[model samples]
Every structure is written in structure tokens, then in C-alpha cells.
Target: MPNLTITEMNNLKEELKKKGYKLTPQRRAIVDTIIENEGKHLTVEEIYDEVKKDCPEIGLATVYRTILLLEELQIVYKLDLNDGCSRYEMVHKDEIHRHHHLICTKCGSVIEVEGDLLENLEVKIEKQYNFKIKDHSVKFFGICQNCGE
Candidate 1:
């Protein structure tokens, strides 16, 4: 699992600072939670649950704000599949696992897949469509084994 230590947390803050973002406590907690729960595409409520452990006073609105900021920074990504709920992933620059999601329709569970596969698809799409792909995301949704009947 991709987890971050206090040092890593501090380093991330420094990196964000370099990117002109001051790391607030709420942002740090959310980012830490994302790293700890890496590969899980967490909804804002789920993130709020994890973040409240460290920042008990933080609110859901703050969670939403922090995630939006992170997404703008390319530090977090969202998967909106024509569904009301949007799931988020942390952008781990050093990890092998990446942002694609395999969502279990019945249980709403999420799995992460390596990104190189999608890179290949992007190449193919660009070749066929001649549309320069700036960035891309992929999601697979189906009944999980537990509910696959």
C-alpha cells in the first residue's frame, strides 16, 4: 500500500509550496489520508471520515474545497461516471499504481490499475482520431465478485 510518513507529509507540503500552494492542516490531513488509502477512489464523505481523525474540527465543505484544490494541482484526480458521486485518487508521482479505477457496481468498491495500459490506448486514439489527447482517465464498472451472479 502507498502510505506517507510524517517526513513524506512534510516533503509534500514543501513541494506544494514550491507550486505556490500553502499547505493547510486540512489539506495535509486529506492528502495523508489519500496516500494511506492509496488505490481506493474515495468520495468526499469517506475522505472527511479519515481526515476528521486528525482534524476533528474540519468540515465536509473544507474537505470538498481541499480536494478541488488538489485536483487543480494535479495532486488529486476525480472519476465522474455520469453518476452523482465522484471518486478521487491521489497523484503519486513515484508509484507504479495509477489513477484508473475498477469500480464494483454492487458494493461500490474501487480497485486501482497501473496507468501504462491507458497510455497505449491514448496513442491509439490519437492515431485514429487525430485528436491530441492532453490527459485521460479510464473507469470500469461492473458487479464485483461478491455480487456477480
Candidate 2:
């Protein structure tokens, strides 16, 4: 992920405040985990385990609530890779509206593919079907190089 600018950081804080939310230490830690591990697509249990190392008093329920709140605020994007668990990643403020995913069926690894590969396709679909595509997500399932051997 690109480095976060001061303005973006301030805007996030302001937005939270506007929503009657405080930037508590727990919340900050959770956000940091998501940002630092950008494309890892971490699950709630994974996040809770990581946060607990630093904040022992934090509970699993608290982590779940924080993740749900972050998702609601658009600070993080929830991903469902058909892996039977919901994963999340930080939202890149200046990138394409969404990112694609490469799912390794053998090992269940997820690789993020950057760039909007569907711009032209979306335009064609919109014109042909008279549909306005607001948001889109794509996932390609295959065996990773490591697992293919």
C-alpha cells in the first residue's frame, strides 16, 4: 500500500469524530494491523490474535465489533474468497475503486491483482444492457506456482 498522507490521516480522524466515534488505542491498533498487512486478507480471529499480543485486555468480541464498524465506515473492505471465512484489507484512498484477487485453490492463498481490468468491459456492458455498474469484484481460482509443481 502507498504511504498514507497527513491529509488522509486527518480526514479519517475527522470522519470518525463526525460519526461520534473516538480514535481509541484499540481501534488504532486494529487499523494499523490492516494497513500494515494490506493484502494479507486477514480474518477476524487472525486480527484478534495479532492485536491481543499488544493489548491483552482486548477481547475477541471487541475485535469483531471493531472490524464490523470499520467495514461500515469504509475504512476497510470485507472480502469473501469462498474460503468459508470473511477477510479484510485496508482501503487505498487513491487507487482504483476496487482490486481483483487470485485465489490459489490448492493452498488457499490469495494474491491481489492491481489495476482496473474491467473499465472497457463495464462501459460495454452499461451501453449494451443499460446498466450502471456501481462497484465490482472478481476472483480467479487456480493453483499457485508453488502448488502446481
Candidate 3:
């Protein structure tokens, strides 16, 4: 688990500018919402709710479009799971995108875990099973602590 920093945000904004992006006031508000909620992976609806506080005229469709643009710019990453709407997090992966998470099925709680758990398994599949693996995503689902109670 890591925190999003102002420095990273600055870099992202600069990157966006280099790519001919104009930061509209509404878009800035949306990006602020995402940073203010660093570790909490948020869906478009959730982001729109937060963005609305700053830009009352902002629409859900605008949020969706902004999210898609940011994702294309690699300023955001979309999380894929078997359930629920897509959630997004801001990340700049210059190195290995090496994080996995556990998701609670009942309450939709997400817990971050590290340390290349799939590395050895991927290697074994390539060697023993003769399967050349490019990449993989794994998300375990179960009842979370609060939900279990």
C-alpha cells in the first residue's frame, strides 16, 4: 500500500500537457478527487460524487470520459474483477506492475498484498507446462473481517 504524492500529480499534469491535454477546471477537480482518495479504488459513480462537490455542473458522463482519457494516458489504471463496475486507481508503473490484492466478495473490501506471489508459478508453467506466459492477474475473493462478523 502506497500513498499518492503531490510530486507524482505534478508529473502527471506535465505529462498530460506534453500530450496536448488541457486541464479543464472540471477535469482538475476529478483528478483531485482521485488523489484525495489515493488508496481507495473508486468507480466512476464514486468519483463523480466527489467531483460534484467542486464542480456542481459536472456530469457522470464527463467523469467517465475523463477517467477513460486518464486511463489512456496511463495516469490511471482500471481494475478488473469478476463483479461490480470497474474501479480505478492512479499509478505510474515504470517498473514491474507488481501488486496483487484480495477482494472481499460480500462487502467489496480490497486488501493490498505484495511480493510476486505468482512469479514462481508463472515460471513453473513456462518450464513444466510449456506455456509461455506474458502476464496474469489474480484476485482472491472472500468475506472480509467486518462482513464475516
For each candidate, give its TM-score against the true structure.
Answer: 0.75, 0.91, 0.77
Candidate 1 structure lDDT = 0.77
Superposition error at 89 for model 1 (Å)? 1.3
Per-residue CA lDDT of model 2 for 28-112, tens digit only, reads: 8888777777778999999988888889999999899989888888888889999899999887777666799999989998888
* Candidate 1 Cα outliers beyond 4 Å, as residue runs: 1-11, 81-83, 94-98
Can you write out model 1's per-residue Cα lDDT over 68-114, one digit (the tens) per residue?
A: 88888778878785468888877766744455667788887766666
Give RMSD to native, each candidate.
3.3, 2.2, 3.6
Pairs that collide in candidate 1 are none
Number of the top-ranking candidate, with lDDT as the measure: 2
Comparing 1 with 2 on lDDT, the higher-scoring candidate is 2
RMSD of 2: 2.2
TM-score for model 3? 0.77
Q: Where does model 2 exceed 4 Å of error?
A: 1-5
Q: All models: lDDT? A: 0.77, 0.85, 0.79
Q: What lDDT, from 0 to 1, does candidate 3 have? A: 0.79
**TM-score for predicted model 2 compared with the true structure:** 0.91
